[model samples]
Target: MNGAQDLGGMMGFGPVVPEPETLRFHADWEKRALAVTLAAGAMGVWNIDTMRHTRESLPPAEYLSASYYEIWAKALANQLLADGLVSREELREGHAQEPPRPVPRVLQAADVAKTLAAGTQYERAAEAPAAFARGATVRTKVFHPTHHTRLPRYARGKRGVVEAVRGVFVFPDTNAHRQGEHPQWLYTVRFTGPELWGEGADPGLTVSIDAWESYLEAA
Candidate 1:
């Protein structure tokens, strides 16, 4: 799923310009987009990983040109369409052309505060002992999966040391594909900048990534 969105270590994008003041959104539509996405998500048709995969799966050109909330809006639309909740004609006309499908849960306005406070947790009970421990050296498996994966492209096949065991968590690769949580141990792996980038990368610079057990092998 290599796309324009995975520009972590790539060059030519120019330095990131941070806003002086943090704003929830830059436009009114952006607020509405977030609201719609949250509301749709409350229905439980898809999980958070699926939502992310939908956004990341957009065409490279479209993904690059789209603003942040625009991607969310597009992804939400795609999810709704894929789940048979809405039709293409209905999306164009901005009105329902058929009966609405029943959902398991609905997010009421009164419950918004409680729902926001109790965020969904991905952490789960460990099913087995961790394969690697802190200070253990490991190598990431080089992979290019067609489905959703949290492992970034730059870190693939790179060697790093386990810094900490973050405990077992729901594996997003399977969760996104409706293949169950398939919980696995997660760890913070530290890698030198040169290992991920090239020889020209700063020798003093180091990066840490929370990698899933499935992505790593003992080195």
Candidate 2:
């Protein structure tokens, strides 16, 4: 899904301004937003890919205007509504109008530390041999999927060399749609700036992206 969130090589936006001191949250509500998102995620109603897709699926205008945490909050709300976890009226009133649905898993405060330490891992056992090896040239498939995809728009159809085999990992394209892990080989592909952007791009600049096997083909 092409959206404002995929601002990889696009122009017009000013240079990124880094904060003097990196704080986790800029405001109190942002903290709460993170907490709510984490808590809701514990229910296992959706995968991390689905959550990301929801965030990226926001309207271009709204996504551009929203802050970082605001996007998370909005995405969380959308998931809750879509999954039947909450009702539109309930969201509007800020109170439950009906009985709450029972969730299979709940995140207790006592388990927060352990849960945070054991983050979600996407890597899985290799199901088959890798199609391409290190130093092999490959091209990313030009695609505009309506569902979730990790491949960025700028790199589509571009040729790059496989730099490293990062092992098999759950394919986000299928995982987000509840189509199973569908694990595939992952690799770090290196591309010159000129290949991605126009020839005017800095020749000294090179970019590396971790691409799934499904997104690439032998060049």
Candidate 3:
């Protein structure tokens, strides 16, 4: 989906600035927000892709104005309400109004470390041979769907060379909509800056993106 979150080459946003890696949370509430988001995610009701879709699906105005964790918190609240785990009154009251709900798994305090260390795996066994090989030229298919997609808007309809075979992995487009994983071969596609940004871009500049097989076709 083309959301405000997909601001790549768009102008008027100002130049990108690098942030120091030393800083983690800017506020106490941010820490709590991350914990709550992770805890709710442990319910197994939705995957990461779905959570991202929900977050990015926020109204353009709302999505653009909110902060990072604000988006996460809002999206989580919406997901909770949509899943029937909480009611509007409960959310307003800040207390449970209905009986307890069952989840597939619970994240215990002791298991937090183990769970964090063992991240969920997205890679899946391939059912077919890779469609494109390293160094092969391919063009990205140009179409917009009203669902979650890993391919960015700026990169669509562009031609690039396969840089590496990243193995088969769960495709986010279908998985984000609860349609199924439908895993596909993954590849690192490298595009020249001039090809993507026109001749005005720096000739030596290049960008690489992890693209799924479905997003590319033989050039």
Whole-model Cα lDDT of every candidate shown, in order: 0.92, 0.92, 0.93
Model 3: worst 10 consecutive residues (lDDT sum): 10-19
TM per prediction: 0.97, 0.97, 0.96
Output the lDDT of residue 135, model 2: 100
Candidate 2 residue lDDT tens string, 3-122: 778888777878788876766677899889989999999888999999999999999999988998899999999999999989999999999899989888999999999999998998
Clash number for every model? 0, 0, 0
TM-score-better candidate, 1 vs 3: 1
Rank all candidate structures by their TM-score, best first, as comma-separated numbers. 1, 2, 3
Report the C-alpha lDDT of model 3 over 3-73, residue by residue, as the tens digit: 98887887886666878999898899999999999998987999999999999999989998898999999
Write model 1 residue lDDT over 1-219, tens digit each, in one string.
Answer: 786778787777667888857676788999999899998899988999889899998998899889989999999999899889999999999999999999889999999999999999999998899999999999999999998898899899999999999999999999998999999999999999999988799999999889999999999
The segments of candidate 2 whose C-alpha lies over 4 angstroms from its true place after superposition are: none
The residue pairs that clash in candidate 3, if any, are none
